[model samples]
Target: MSNSRSTKLHVAIFPCFAFGHITPYLQFSNKLAKRGHRVSFLLSKGAQAKVEHLNLYPNLIHFYPLLVPSVDRLPPGAEATSDVPFPLHGHLCIAIDQTLDQVQTVLSSLKPDFIFFDFSLWMPALAHQTGSKAIYYSVITPVAQALKVPSKQKPEDMTLEDFMQLPPGYPSSSVRIKSKDFETAQLKVVANDLGTGMSIYVRITSSMIWSDAMAFRTYHEVEGPYCDYLRKHYGKPVLLTGPVLPETPATKLLDEKWTNWLCNFKQGAVVYCAFGSQNKLQKDQFQELLLGFKLCRQPFLVALSTPDGCATIEEAFPEGFEESVKGRGWVYGGWVPQTLILEHPSIGCSVTHCGYGSMLMVEELKVAVEVEREDNGWISKESLSKAIISVMGEDSEIAGLVKYNHAKLKEELTSEGMQERYLGTFIQNLQGLLD
Candidate 1:
């Protein structure tokens, strides 16, 4: 169990198709590699290309590419969930399942001491076949994972209102939905049901039963009770890997235009809005978010991710809306260096989709004012305005609490803090299981 050079473990990591999941798995693999362990970080050929752009330890962490088969109504070479339209994601899952035989073959050949697999339900089977200890690494929040704890009644069988309620026997009411707030309940349910043959829930619960242990990309300080609930329900050792934070963009001056624009505002005067890479806002909802920032009359920098095959960002904006808010708003269509933006002095609060990876980074710096979505995943202009005001309001108590929690969480989740507290013991435990 010691971190001895002679006792190094060879670990294989297989994350789900999404970059959100893939990115963190890579971070963990790098951590393992830094500790003198060897890692075979496996992904689809397309996903391999995506990770290559990030920091990769070539000598210690090797890449193994799996070819994803084409699915019905899904285009060829679309291995990632983000590559396809929202409705066709089910087809992507079917394609992922088809790769199981190939994965089993590869795992058998590699014969790694352990297999760290993502949320794919079919994955543990490969680990089982290869006699490798299976570990489930969840990239989502603990609350979402808690809500997913297997229930007697299927989620599809219940009403949306009923579906919003936390399954019975959960240890806390903090995440429970007494009303129609499904955000606290099943924000991920839609994606879960989008799979073709096996439902996302079915895969999740099955893996919980099959896997030797479960790991979360979260820390106990933030969701300790929920973590405890998962341990009791799944009957396994649940490990917190701390928040696997993304590396900030290397350069401070990431973009000239955005940098100059952000400088115009006073300290803590701007609202930074971004709904992660995968979330594509509809035309109406997208306009409403823009208007919401205007309504608050706060200087803002917003990154609006255009839907697949949609018109350009300029066309998507409401007629004259951009010009009206021209002096105060800076709207962008695609990728931006978010960590650098958050670090800017004018940036005050954030309005986010609460994506696991985005929230992990956002929470480490400033208070995140999360906007709730409707059934169609749209937030009204009114709701958006209220959230912007609540977080950016100078004398707001809620804003203060959010900032305090961020400071506390940042202290606990720093790279050195995490490796010393959780990941070190996590490896020791895995070694114990191996022996």
Candidate 2:
């Protein structure tokens, strides 16, 4: 219905049911719609609210229905989506096996100019059938560009520094960033680093080799030298959209509430803890994390995925921890507005799964990116998506440092530091692209 140059440019956006999954894609959708593109967002019953809150629901043509299996195996509310995070791994084949049957019917009915695939591996056939220009959007940074991953990131226009490299492993390969000189100097420090395993190496290899183009959620100012590194390394058309996130005022108000409570705490005094939407901490393990918070005596917010499938910050917290922390701590029973919390004046640190947006938003939120998303196979599979693969890497040292150096970045996005670079680069790239 849009009567612009891109009126016929219809884009179908699909993100998983998790908060971490939907946030980045919605940011991209808003920008695309502003650019005169017709954007259609498809959601399973689970992610319906998020679509509306982020303001993408009104723009969509239809909602995809998940086939409810006859077996009462799924938890009561979780019927529409398969809670086990396996199918979303970026393999085009597996995704098709699990979702294509339903997705195919909907896509076939609504023809569009382009299909903004969610770094989903299971999209080639659908793309081919629709004859649509497939733009694979990444929620993370670009590794093929060495922009997000932790290894020896080489600069653009910089010559190869005769570094000894690790070969790409099977199933996927690793991006080995060894500094010929830095390696020699820190051989002792580097020796103790536990590197990537065989599977991670393979997954990264596949993503870098595939994916038509990448829309990473990193800013050039924030990443600076690293963003430059990505431009030179990646083969695909790389678009670095700084912290593609929804930083709403309501979200910020909640952040202020928490910040107010932290008045007793010093600047950089609280430890904001959380994991992504999908991964779960068994009640016992979840308790241990809470125990750690108690031991650290730090102000924290831990969002939890619900027993019935919806996301809740409180349900995931220890049974009665919320009542106990009412004055001193916070518990996000559902998807907490993460970006807002990190950007708050009182927030000094974060305990997180080292997710892409989680890492990027920290710049503006003025917090550090800490914690690693549990590196299980499910995460490995999704990492094949450019967004996930590019923002974070599969290297051992990089993973550790994402945690080790987090506290160092506690200052938030500086007015003049790397943060500015990320924003300037993003605005420049998005300049006319949205017009």
Candidate 3:
């Protein structure tokens, strides 16, 4: 199918304040721009610098800065992952509400042909009202494998009864893990029963995102089983856009001494540890992670995100701790050379929050073995283990049921791969089934 080249196909992209959410949207717009589409990336004031750092960014890609209210109470803009204070989280919710108003107006004036939205915005209907092709770009969920036979098994299928009643090890996070769209219909019913007033905006965003025609990030070779499950059950098409990451040219800008040190390691040797943009660690949680890395005893690089006033690692962690991990690890306050670090020959594994961007990176590069946190996706642990077992250990159980099936995915990733993001498989699925 020949896609008529979009000559200045103006596209608007927006994400929440969290870096994990914001980064993927920026990467998506970048891909669109490369295909000759005019792109505008919506970002908070503080978030603009990272996107601006890209050579073709902000200048070639139009930028709309959100004048987010500087509330005194909030923590610095990071994900809700760690020990960020109550004021910080409350501020984020406030900022989100504020951005919604700003975003609505922006869409009204720019009047782009298409608008790509991340899940947190709560305003898909607003974009739709602006006469834009609202693409509900999901950073979560699995690929839909539309094969002739059922190649995957969901958690609900195997058990004696409800899988939640089973032990923690039972497999969950399937393509058929209960259709979020189908469940929302039930939620609409339950909400009506209770006579609660969750806003119409919330309802609309939920409906669009949970719809079966939404796109998935994993390539078919990587998430074949989840894709198969969805293909077998819903028959709704799914687009499979593989790993999306930004280019970091800053490493070469580093001083000679530090640059020389980075050159010494073999490719894929260092482990980069970070919770996703939303997860802020309590002081103890931060230390527990520190201890976990100390146990691993490998070369580590960590990105320690902090609130604006609470940016000090010395205050957050124990003193002289920098000396303890010196030479072995490097920790930055915010932002690191993520794609460059993962693809680095010396870098080996990563400890991450199992976020989409981070998950996509490890999956594409086969870079890390993740330390299990809350299991957000059924495929994450299975995928990470498959990617990292050679450098780490044998396949340990992820959310249970020994994904012995992951062996095939592991082999596929180690060979020729897919980095689909633009007019890739998932977008095709959306145009075919959901449009």
Task: Tell me the TM-score of each prediction against the true structure.
Answer: 0.87, 0.58, 0.64
lDDT of 2 by residue, 215-299 (tens): 5666554555444554445555566655544536343355455556667666655556566666655555565566556544556
> Candidate 1: deviation at residue 233, Å?
1.5
Instruction: List the candidate 2 regions with Cα displacement exceeding 4 Å.
Output: 1-8, 56-82, 85-96, 144-211, 220-235, 247-269, 305-327, 330-335, 355-435
Query: Model 2 lDDT vs. the true structure?
Result: 0.48
Candidate 3 ranges with C-alpha deviation above 4 Å = 1-8, 55-60, 70-91, 120-122, 143-213, 224-237, 245-258, 264-269, 276-278, 306-311, 315-334, 355-435
Q: What's the lDDT for all of these models?
A: 0.75, 0.48, 0.52
lDDT of 1: 0.75
Pitting candidate 2 against candidate 3, the one with the higher lDDT is: 3
Give one digit per residue, the lDDT tens place, for model 3 in 1-435. Answer: 234332346778776566666667667667656656678777776667655656355455888878765555555554332324533444455555667778888889988766776544355567668866666566655521121122224321222123112122222332222234433343233223121233223332353444334455556655655565654454545455665545454554544544566676656556666655455556655655665565566666778775334557667755566788888767666656556555565765556664233333334333343443333322233344343344454344531222333444555544443454335544444334323
Q: Can you list the residue pairs that collide in candidate 1?
A: none
